[model samples]
Target chain A: MRSQSRIAFYLLLTPLVLWLGLLIVIPHIDMLLISLRERISFGVYDRSLLQYEKALTEPLYLRTFARTAVMSILATAITLIIAFPVAYYIAKMAKGRLQQVLFLLCLIPFYVSELVRTFGWMILLRETGIVSNLLQWTGLADQPVELLYTDATMMVGLVYTSMLFMVVPLVTTLESLDDSVIEAGYDLGGNGFSVLREIIIPHAMPGIVSGCIVVFMLSLGNYLTPTMLGGKDSLWFTEMIYNQFIVRSNWELGAAFGFMLLVLSSVIVWGMLALTGRTLKETMG
Target chain B: MIPTIPTSRAFRLTYGAYVALFFLYLALPLTVVAVFAFNDSQFPSLPWDGFTWAWFFGTERPQIGVFHERGILRAVGTSAFVAGCVAVLSVAVGTTNAFLFNRYEFRGKGLLYVLMLLPLVIPGIVLGISILIFSSTLANGIWDLAQMDIQALRPGLLLVILGQFSFITTIATLVISARLQKFDRTLEEAALNLGADRLTAVRTITLPFLAPAMVGAVVVAFLMSFENFNTTLMLVGSDAPLTIAMFDRLKEGSTPLLNAVSLLLMLGSSLLALLVILFQRRP
Candidate 1:
């Protein structure tokens, strides 16, 4: 029996080992190596730190990185604000079929491609789009307003895209809480707001932390939303990395940028783990 | 039950209104896309010229009406194939891992579990670009050793599948693992005690229990792979997937056909989900 268990364990470990080695470890090693290398003309990578040095000193790349950080922070804040109430409602208020349906509604967006969703935003926010046209007719604006191609529009897209991620884990954690605990708090003379503040929020801390980590990471790494919505002038960090690699053919600089973003994400994940006193396995799995 | 204050009718109405407004916000984009699918205008937006099926069925030559575009159809086919392959492969690997992890205790177990999950937290752009670079480098080395003529290893179907599978498999494993945790270990123990071998006990007792979760994981995995854009954008070869194709067209400008495609995709996925739910609820 012990031998059989050992065999089973080894079998389970094999796929994970193979996946990590091939996908994560190897790719990262290659990226690191390339980051140390030089780039030839026409986007071909040659063997030097010239690109990294240049990227580090360049004001454009620095500015873009700072802008991405600010945008990601703001988007994360907005997503949390919108998602918390809905998650609270679903977790504490809704039950049975209604809960299932509401949860499914949150997930349905996952089925649609991001491209399509963003396009929908484009149609809604364009000069002759619904929002703009409505604003014009209502005399909110003299003419159709230009709402597209701005940071605000980009934030709208990011928050909308990532809200589900925040809501799901929050719901799951909140659902696991004992309703009687809240009832007890009320029985002991706590008001609704006080119960929520002292009991519910603390209990759901892990979920909130996990949700924030996810939203932040996704927002930081997101390139497409910022590019499509913010238009040509948008200098998102991911876009900068993309330009370095694809447009300028500077792999080392791109690698440096990629590494920076990676380290930042890892730090955030680590901070969340420390704060919540739980491992990634616990939160994610 | 503790006595609670009854919510007023006005409060209930306000809450209902809020919920309705939220749903409207969520559904508005989808509704617009679906409605514009029937629009006669070339553009997807308002001021409907007339109602027509010309976009759906018109074949004017290279371009086709709007719906008959060969590129869109080909991209859709490619996406389906790739997503299908990813789903099957991920489910197979994920289920096996789940069984192994759940059924037995062994050395390096925690480390292996962490390794499985690393892909989930990693950024998609980094994953995509790294995979592209690694694959090309490896392909170059293999070609040199074998002396085979293979040019440009970066963009292709294989890379896209690899890129997608890396993350999708994590999702599958996580889902299956959750299901496995709730499974009764006593059933397997009884089977083993009753003169059944490990494989047979697993085949009869465990596999049947895990089948639904495995199926659900496959569906979710397939959908994720199908809708994938960031990684696909980075790793896809010259040939575009449906998402990338739509993105390209949108970049040029909005067209009603893109909305048509979105509506079709939305309807198709919802129908599939409905079927799966019905099937699951049948027994």
Candidate 2:
């Protein structure tokens, strides 16, 4: 029986070991190693930081990287602001069938693929899109105003794509908070704004942090939305990474850029958790 | 719940309006996508020429429907095939990992579990590139040493499968583990003590219990795999999945046939999502 149990244990351990170890861990370590090396000649290499140096020194790369980070942060903030009230209403204010229905509505768009979602945005924002047509119909515009590719358009797409991620976590955390806690704050000479600032926000911090982390990472990593909505001028850092790896076949440089993104996201996630006094286990779990 | 903070009529009206608009914002893009599928125009966009079904059923010129477009149809098949493979593989491994986490108290388990989730945070692009670099390097090394070329290591369907499986399995495990944690272990133990072998007990009792969650995980994994663009984009070869195919076409510019495809995809995903939601509603 002991032997059987041991065998079963090994059976379970095998897949986890191979899946995480072979797929996730080793590849990342290897990417780091590859990023650190500089190819000198045929079948020869030198240990160097050339890739990192290039990423830092190149104006285009540096600008795009900074832009991606800033844009992602902005997107996260916007999504949070937008999602919080909605999540609050769903979790606390709404009741019964309406609550379930509202939550489902939030989720339905997400079930549609990102590509399709982005396409939908494209259709609505293009010169001949529904909005433009509506404008033309209202005689508000003499000509079709092209709105498909712009920074604002990209932001909208990013926020739209990320809304559900923020909402889901926010709703989960908010729903668990007792109504009396908020009521007590209100009863004790607190207004809605004050109560929310103290009681609700504090309770929802973990959800907020998790949601922000996810939205930021997603917005940061997002390739389709920005490229599609922002056009060739998108200058997204991920696009740079793709250009390096696929277009230019510069794996070393691409790996460096990839590592930079990884580190940046990790630091931001760590920063959010630390600032909120939460741990990865609590937030992620 | 009743005697909460004083809510003025104005405030309530404003809040209700906000909720209404928010739902509209959520619904509009997708609604437009679906509505345009029936728009009888060359472009997917506005000023509807008239309502028509050519996007789905037409077979000539720009009006060629998604069904008639061999490339689109083929890509859909590829996407479905990849999703199916990814779903099955991720869920199987996920179930095993769930058991590993839930049943064991091994040293470094916490660390291992954290490592398992590392994929979730790693940007899909980076994940794709890392696997691409590692596998190609490994493949090259093998070729140099053993004079053998490994096609699977190159950017292709196999790598796409591996790339998606890496992260999807984490999600699958999370979903399955949630269900497994609630499972009464004593039922399996009782079966084992009452003359049933351990395997039989697990097969008949534990698995039957886990079926709902497992099914839900499968659907989630499948949809995720299907909709996956970032990682798949990096690893895809000549045969692109539906998302990659749609992306490529969208870059060139879109036609209403793409709308047709989007409508079909939305319907399919809604059905799958409804199934999972219905399953969750079960006790």
Q: Model 1, stretches more than 4 Å misplaced? A: A1-11, A39-49, B1-3, B6-16, B61-67, B144-146, B150-152
Per-candidate TM-scores read 0.93, 0.98
lDDT of 2 by residue, B211-240 (tens): 998999999999999999999989999889
CA lDDT of B19 in candidate 1? 68
Q: Write out the backbone clash pairs for model 1.
A: A37-A48, A38-A48, A43-A249, B58-B65
Lowest lDDT 10-residue stretch of candidate 2 chain A? A276-285
What fraction of correct interface contacts does each candidate retain?
0.50, 0.78
What are the DockQ scores of the candidates, in order? 0.55, 0.74
Top-TM-score candidate index:
2
Error of 2 at A128 (Å): 1.6
Task: Identify the leading candidate in terms of lDDT.
Answer: 2
Model 2: lDDT of residue B10: 90
| TM-score computed on alpha carbons, candidate 2 | 0.98
